[model samples]
Target: MSEITPDLVRHLGVLARIQLSDEEVQSLTGQLDAIVDNIAKVSEVATPEVVATSHPIPLENVFRPDVVQQQLTREQVLRNAPDQADGRFRVTAILGEEQ
Candidate 1:
């Protein structure tokens, strides 16, 4: 397994635009080394015959029947609006002219 050196960590930090202290770089080097080692082990076990799966359990499409349902009347839909005009909800103007 390859070791993650401080130089590698510093390079990664530079690429990611992350400012890291000397101690932080050293600490992250060790952590990243362990993670790489674990990934190497996982990669070794993956075989050509084994199919890759996104989800562990089998999945089935669950769909509801498309049936038209009753809808609220215009008055019922607009009942809770604080302001309304011309059978629709009224909203305040969004833009103003430059002074």
Candidate 2:
């Protein structure tokens, strides 16, 4: 079993942008060590014949039948906009460049 020390915890905290006190570092070291040990045991069981799968169950793509639908007219579409002018939806200037 790998030993997780204060130095390791402090290094991890710095990498993750976290600040930990001496007591917190000690506590986290034990917890992290146990987690690493468990992971190591799991890795040991994995074999060459067993393919790694992200999900436990196999999945298939589900597709719906394609169908044509009526779309809104330009006037109707513009009606929903907060600002409209000259038969079109007028939007505020996005870029700072002058027109």
Candidate 3:
């Protein structure tokens, strides 16, 4: 188990260029100690035989097979366009840029 001390917290604060008060130093020492202890507990349970996983439950992709089929033609698609030019849909120029 790793033990976090007020002196270590103060040193970290100095390295980080942070000005910590005595109260902050004491509080961070306890907080950091708890974090380290919890991490150690987790490490103890994580053995080499145990597989690491991002999720508790198994995950799989539910994908449909890719199949090609007949689709609409360009003229059929352009029939509903409010405005089109040069065999394609056209819109007003934006941001003062020209085509």
Better of 2 and 3 by lDDT: 3
Give the lDDT of residue 76 in candidate 1.
100
lDDT of 3 by residue, 17-93 (tens): 89999999999999999999999999999999999999999999899999999999999999999999998999987
Candidate 2 structure lDDT: 0.90
* TM-score of candidate 1 against the unseen true structure: 0.56
- Model 2, 1-99: lDDT tens per residue? 787888999999998889999999999999999999999998998989888988999999999999989998888898789999998878888898543
TM-score of each: 0.56, 0.56, 0.54
Candidate 1 displacement at residue 73 in angstroms: 24
In the order shown, the candidates' Cα RMSDs to the true structure are 8.5, 7.9, 11.5
Model 3 root-mean-square deviation = 11.5
Per-prediction backbone clash count: 0, 0, 0
* Candidate 1: regions farther than 4 A off: 59-99
| Sliding window of 10 residues with minimal summed lDDT for model 3 | 90-99
Error of 3 at 62 (Å): 14
Can you tell me which runs of candidate 2 are displaced by over 4 Å? 61-99
